[model samples]
Target: MKHVKIAGGLGFIGFHLAQKLLDEGWLVTAVDSLENRSELKLALEMELGRNAHFTFLQTKIEQVDFGDADVVVYAADNENRAALEAVLRKCQPDCLFVFLSTTDVYEYSGEWRVQPVTEYGKAMLAQEENIRVTCAETGGAAVIIRLPTVYGLHQPYHLKLGRQFVSYEDETGKTESMHDLLYIDDVTSALAAAMAIDSGQHTIHLGSGTSNPFERTGKSNGLDYQKAHELLGFFPRTSLAEGIKKYQLAHEEWQRQKKLAAMYDETKSMAAKHPNTNQ
Candidate 1:
């Protein structure tokens, strides 16, 4: 079996990717710091822990040993360029390095360019360059996936604009926006396909390939899956309506769990203070 190591296996995207790879019969080592806002970490741990082919490591990317991994996936949120370069240098020459980048690197023209409008975009661009230079020096293979806004169950609230459409309260206060979106499953499939293909230092853009204007009231324009279909032989199977419904259900469950945990803690505190009264 091929050995895969994910740097941010506990994160929203990383966790989903790791699960997909494990289901495909690959031995996966998930290295994560467990320092994210999502409350699904425990759920992920319980699920992946049952798999014999999965291993979860709670640590930074620079501290792990990647000598035996056939592929190293950089999915962490950290933007430390030096740490990423060091990790790539330590990997075996045959190991393929896959970096998850963002479409923010492009301007409004829809063309891939080096100019980024935000700090986050600039950081991602720098990291992409680091991977390219490192692979060039080590004579290794690398693939950079530039993705648009990705959304599904357990997705971070900040990354998905659909969160605003889930409720009528309008948390973001924005009525509508035109953006490209891709389902989590489609993104994972694209990543798997990249692993199977023997592409040498290539950059691929992943998106629904259509500019859809979404309103805060859960309505959207049409979707176009031409680019992803032609390139990866894959297209998003989940409709926007279904995806949003699933996301809303998951968010409700998460909130319920959080309340239960708080109540349990409060009961314990009361019991400790009234020991004599109970006797």
Candidate 2:
């Protein structure tokens, strides 16, 4: 069985990708610190734990034993740079190092802006360079993926809705910005396809490839994935309307679960206080 190690394995994208691989009968080791703790995080952890093929390691990135791993997918954004570099150095020649980088690697401008990297972009660029250099020297492979704004089930932010935030209060700052919107499943599929390529190096930009308004003022346009399609042999299958509908359904279910958990906790608290009075 192919072994894939995923950093930030409990995150929105990471969790979904791990689930996909696990379902496809791959052995997955998910490393996460759980620093960004949330109900969804815990729920995803529990869900992935149930799979016998999945291994959850609540630890730092550098500490993971990348022993015999066929693929390494770094899905985490905020990690110690030195530690990440050290991890890259540890990758063996046969390992395929996959980095989930952001389009933020470019200057702040339109959706496809290039050159003059931002601070975060510089950091990602450095990591990509590290992956490439390390792999080139060791005869390993590396796939650096630049992603746009991604949303789906377990989505923490509602970038397009503008009406509500998924995991934050409505009073939060305006999320109105132009971006290339992508569904989570499409991303996972692209990442999976990237895993198939085990030689040389590649950098792929995955997105709708259009600077659509971030707010849901009107119908989000259909995607044109010709770039990803021609290159990766995959294109986004979910339409914006369909993706939004799925998110809405999942959010409603999450809210219901949250309420039930709160009610259960309240009942337990009451029972604890009245324990001695019960006949």
Candidate 3:
């Protein structure tokens, strides 16, 4: 069982990916700040318990000691500098480093002459030099997955993915935003596949293919979602409807937890005022 280290494994994408790896018989080491206790993570911990071959360290990537892991998934970021620094420090001389970058970098914005990506895409444009320098110095093979807006069962509320549903009549409808919503499961599966590939193809677009380009309706971008089957060999198994249902459930659970916390706080305050209340 090859060990793979995910730097921000406590995050939405990383958390799901970690579970996928566990199912696939890989020894997984997940490192993250776990800034707040995530219900999904707690649930996973309970479900997987001692049987899962996993190690979760509650700390940032830069703080952890990267023991000799076969691959390093550089999922953590503290702006550009800290991001590159973590990679350089954690990567073994011959390790494969996979970076989860964004497709957002490709947009120059506006409805003008947009360029197709070459030598990996525009996502790496800003931090390209730093990435190259760090990888070169470490003698590590660096792979980059330029991904789009990922949505799935556990989509975090903090992503601010605009309003969930927008009607055509609504002036501020999300349909106008025109973004590709990549399923989280697809993202996780793609990374696991990339890790398995024994090739030098270090850069690949982990998207739902051109058929599912950023669009409100299929006609908006002249994209036919059906093409994902042929081109990317990827069809989102979970539809937006199913994914949103789960997301809504997570949101409701979070609200419930919040209310419980408030109620407990009030009870504690009352108890303090009446010291003999327990007696």
Query: Where in model 3 is the C-alpha error above 4 Å?
Result: 37-50, 78-80, 108-124, 158-178, 198-201, 210-214, 217-279
lDDT (Cα) of model 3: 0.61
Q: Give the TM-score of candidate 2.
A: 0.80
Which lDDT values do the candidates have, in the order given?
A: 0.73, 0.75, 0.61
Residues 199-273, candidate 1, lDDT per residue (tens digit)?
Answer: 478777665644443434334432344555665676777666667776678779877877987899899999898
On TM-score, the stronger of 1 and 2 is 2
TM-score against truth, every candidate: 0.77, 0.80, 0.67
Per-residue lDDT of 1-279 in model 3, one digit per residue for the tens?
899888877666787888888899988888877677776676555444554698888876677767578877876652456756765677677677777765544443332122424323343554545666777776667666666667655545333333333223333412111235666777787788667543242545544434334344554222223433343455556555666666677669867866887799899999898888554
lDDT of 2 by residue, 1-279 (tens): 999999889988899999999999999999988877776788888889999999999988888888579999988754357767767777888888888876656544323455534566666777777777777777878888877678888766544353222222342542212335677888999999899988889888776644343534434432346666776887777766777788788879978978997899999999888787646
lDDT against true structure, model 2? 0.75
Comparison by TM-score, 1 against 3, better one: 1
Clashing pairs for predicted structure model 3, backbone only: none
Predicted candidate 3, C-alpha RMSD: 6.6
Pick out the ten consecutive residues of candidate 1 with the lowest summed lDDT: 168-177
Q: Which portions of model 1 show Cα errors greater than 4 Å?
A: 35-39, 110-114, 158-179, 214-231, 249-279
